[model samples]
Target: MLLELIEYHWAEDIDEVLLLLGRLDVKTVPLAGGTYLLGLHDDSIESVVDLRDLDLAYISEDARGIHIGAMTTLQQMVDSPLLKELFAGLLARAAKNSSSSRLIRNSATIGGTIATGSASQADLLTALAVLDAEVVVRSGSKTQVDLKGGSYEHPGLALAGVVYKGKHERRIPSGEVQLSRRPAELIIEVVIPRPTLAVGTALMRVSRTPADVSLLHAAALIEIDAHTYRKVHLALGGSNMEPVRLYGVEQMLEGQPVMNPLNSQKLLTILQEGMATFRPPADIRASSSYRRVSGMGLAYRALEEAMNVASWQNVMSSERGS
Candidate 1:
């Protein structure tokens, strides 16, 4: 809980929120869902600027992709018709698997999830990474940052919205970064681009329990041309604070044929080799060795599932044409 002496301020618009954050004497931040704020017992915080009255919660979609409001809750995301229709309901699926309990899902906001920088373990983040999502931030004006490796949490800065791009020729390589626990900024919304072609996405998580934190999580997005992979994106969490991309693995698999089980077997070797250099953190949830070993399994499985999905979709399309 915040200090008894702390001051509460309600903002009706972005201008008012920024003004409060710019104050010199008071340490302030915009409070969205308060899931993260309540967890913070920092004495340094003197006040909180409530964004509830700002009317930021929104979700919209178009040919380009979906636009998600920063204040949208995980539960809301799970219930979004737009998300359910696009990418075979990938965003909704990920949201369903996030933070097990309904109470937390009801309170946790997507903006808070991304802004907190704990996305390395967030199911929603893993899915977003696979989809090449981007976040819009507003300080005084507006700017867009790639969500794959973006962070915001400065005074007067907040995430305005997110953009998911429609599938195009642009290839989003997979990689992960360490996440920061400190609140950096407010996320207003998220945007996901639509794939130019038929793309298959899959999310996999390995946790100690169904409701517990993920020890290893993997997300895969694949587009195939005939028997060859036209594009591939592999993202991971539990190995780092933010989702890490499997660059070497993606490079090796690009344009490769998946008809042969041998191809996936070969990828398993490459994936293990690529991860050998990095050391995963060890804690009570899982030891370093367990995370690495299990993580590799989840990654391989995700890729395989993605390939299978692409194959099925391709077959269905051909059948329709015929």
Candidate 2:
């Protein structure tokens, strides 16, 4: 299936882009870097309005927070001093392995990343999901996403970017996991603030020789206190119709001990049980049971790593205090 090349229009201003959106058919998708939108050209779209001229594709810095322009490339993030020090957990780790070719990162945009949310699909969103971050979207009106959900709204041509509070002093801690058939295949970047008790997992099992899209994925944000787990947030991608929050896993791990062996086993068992609820229809790549098994390990690994981090932090704090 070959996608036919479509007409390209470079919009100098946002007003022009929005105007074009209002006039074109729903198939007319906006192009930031052509990383994802270009794939749709032959699928259902025919025209692409280039947004490079809008100046919406650069990284902005200020005391309030870091403003990553929707069009900024991954190369910029890879070299961004601000992102390197403050948001290191998310940006540094996520974009570090994007590819050796700077060209792709040079075209990847933060807005495009959030809107497409491929990281979650590709297993990168779990890191950002680990950090409890969202997108800042502007359509008819501007909106804020302090938490996950609504990233895929894809409100046509609009203003977008992943914004971070730049006021924090210390470097934030974040981690990510990718389920890929190859190194640079479709993937997501996960971000984290602190790695105490929270876990972020993005799992994609590609058993179909070379799997595309994904079979199942999960993202988590769990907080285990000094002696007990306090709060938990789990997000599902590719495993459900939309990115879903796993309440069943949350209900089981919110108050467990960080070092208790019995509680740990119970947590793992409960997570596997909750994940069983996900009924991924059989695709050419894998069966429902295979996906379930892989997903179970992915989730458990994320939780286990998050717990170890939490336990390590506790020891560090105690040593510093003493």
Predicted model with the maximum TM-score:
1
lDDT tens digits by residue: candidate 1, 195-309: 6446777889887788877777888998888778888888877623467677777887888776644465677787887666555677666787887777788888898888787
- What local distance difference test score does each model get? 0.72, 0.52
Candidate 1 accuracy as TM-score: 0.81
- CA displacement after TM-score superposition, residue 230 of candidate 2 (Å): 2.5
lDDT of 2 by residue, 61-82 (tens): 5544455666767677778786
lDDT of 2: 0.52
**Sequence-dependent TM-score of model 2:** 0.63
Segments in model 1 whose C-alpha atoms lie over 4 Å from true places = 119-121, 141-185, 260-264
